[model samples]
Target: MNFWYVPWFILPYLLLAFILVKQHKKSNRSNLFFKFIYWSFFYLFIYLGITEIQDKSYFFTIPVLFFVLFSWMYHREKARVLNGFLLNLFIASFGIYLLYNFLITQDVLVFALIFLVGVFVVLVGLFGFVGLMILFYWNALVVIKRESHSLANLLTLILAVVMTIWLIYDSFIAKMLPDWASILLSILPMMFFYFVFAFLNFLSASLLYQFNQPSYDQDFIIVLGAGLVQGTKVSPLLANRIHKAIDFYYQQRKYTRHWVKFIMSGGQGPDEKTAEAIAMKDYALQQGIPEDDILIETNSTTTLENMQYSKEIIDRADIKAPKVIFSSNNYHIFRAGIFARMAQLKAEGIGAKTAFYYLPNAFLREFIAIIAMKRKLHFTIISLLASVLLLLSIIAHFVS
Candidate 1:
């Protein structure tokens, strides 16, 4: 048999391999996710090209390329959980496409009924209907456990309920509503899709930062402050961060001869009698860290300020290109890294453990903050998607 397609198929892979090698060597975290996307598409196109030459019928195997790419990415970076979810979504879409085409080819009536049922089932599963229910119940428990009903605490549950409704309406009632209403509803799904992918990218990037271990030769460790207990003592959340920093400091000392300064960063809230930095610093002193090794940044009211003020202290001390590590709860590590990048500080992150019940809410809060920070890009993309959906709806309405 002739092998005319072999070089064409192999050439792209060779090019992708070269690019991946260069990216790996450059190793910039900012562009790493996009690099992964490029790599995924490279493999996908190769599979499609090979299948096309072999036989058109073999095209059903195209979805397998996505799974293969996901497996490779996961093996390389397990923290890219969102990337796994995204690849799985593509695989699911391919399966749905095959099923729809097969049913339509076999019988139109059967296709309509089966397609409706299948879409409902898949949408329900993808939208996490059952997971949302469980989250709602869990949020209730968390509210009671924490004895606070802050809106932030309820955001995840509220989102789950809203999404469930949106999915149901889009699946079952979109065509039944008035044209304007249908168009608006149609736009919502487009926006939802955009937001889900964007949020996943942010979360994946954040988790990637958390998974990156810092070098042991760091010159500074910045412990970002959470709220204190009655403003006088470190809360469990804050204590965990400080403890992680102390552990890092000791580890650096044990392995390297350089002295690492601990920067306790936080500001005083109105309810607190003392600044968060002072409380963290005191806690560190009690943990037996030397007084000379602890630096206090008492003016930072936010994560960005923590990095900024800590960098100032580092600069003031005349430390040249100080390798730094910032510590926070695991859920907050990614956002801290983002702040560090914004502050133009070269620092890695270390995450302390958090309570199981608190993680979902905390993660949601972080996701919202990330979105806010990139609101311009997100808003523009979302607006464009909504416009496209609305335009398509108008054309379909007129055609019908």
Candidate 2:
């Protein structure tokens, strides 16, 4: 057994220990990303060591170690969606590694059996596209029946149909196209998968944050407003947010000696009879909250404006070192938190429950919004990946 691979395994541990110490000293999202990267490298090194030593039995420990670390990180910060996503990716990579190892080491009979199973899985996946189209159409029709026929409401259904079509074309029709056209078509699926990965990350993070209980030490509770019904009354979505903020206020009062101020943030829209802030305030007062305890921010329409204007109100109140909590519907909390961060407000979020039927469309909209928020970065990554794929295709064409 060559001991040279031992140091390769040990190096990642040392690096991770340093990162862990840094994270403990000053925790932030970037630190979490670094920790994930380091942990992945740690596992990769372990796999390398196992392969070098020819100890196939040790392969089983990789996944066990992955689960242990994933659970520990998830327990530490349940609200971090990116962390969950990284852990999921790690497990997937490990599974692939195991499959590769099995193919290399197993007997011919076992290989043939595995190959047959693999082919079966592929065939099922191909046929599964039809099932996916059915599901998508059903969801689309249900959404159209229950909601308005607006493009926003139909986004998920539209995307599902488009993806299904693209997959079919890429699988069967791309090979018949010109080389450049085929390369471009092939790149679409990769980009789609990347988008799907990102969407899942944001959705998981949002859902995790929604389910976790808010801490009771907040100094302020901000309720973000949605559009009103008929431009006057509070919509069900907006009402849920106010109720969530009130619940948090009462929960905090049980533990804290200070009063938690409620900031109702929303401006009047062109279609509204009154400012969203005014409507939310009136609703909160009717719900039995004192007028003195509620502060109205009546000049903001968007979530970012909600954060910015609300922060001004918090500042005007002369509250020092305010720990704030914002409330929105569950699907909206992740993006709301991002907005709060953009406004330089140190705030956590609590999500009220949303209707189950509405969640998929809502989540899809939020995912698109998040992508738009970092459009430059996303464009750069997709362009680079596509370019590489195109280059590889061109090289293969020339070689052949």
Which candidate achieves the best TM-score against the true structure? 2
lDDT of 2 by residue, 180-268 (tens): 66775678889988998888787766765665555567778999988999999999889999998998787667656557889999999
Candidate 2: segments with Cα more than 4 A from true spot: 1-81, 93-130, 178-181, 254-258, 396-400
Per-residue lDDT, model 1, residue 185, is 69
Error of 2 at 298 (Å): 0.9
Give the distance in Å from residue 400's predicted Cα in candidate 1 to where it truly belongs. 3.9
Q: Candidate 1, which segments miss by more than 4 Å at Cα?
A: 1-128, 178-181
For model 1, how does the per-residue alpha-carbon lDDT over 199-226 read when each residue is reduced to its tens digit? 6666665665555666568888999988
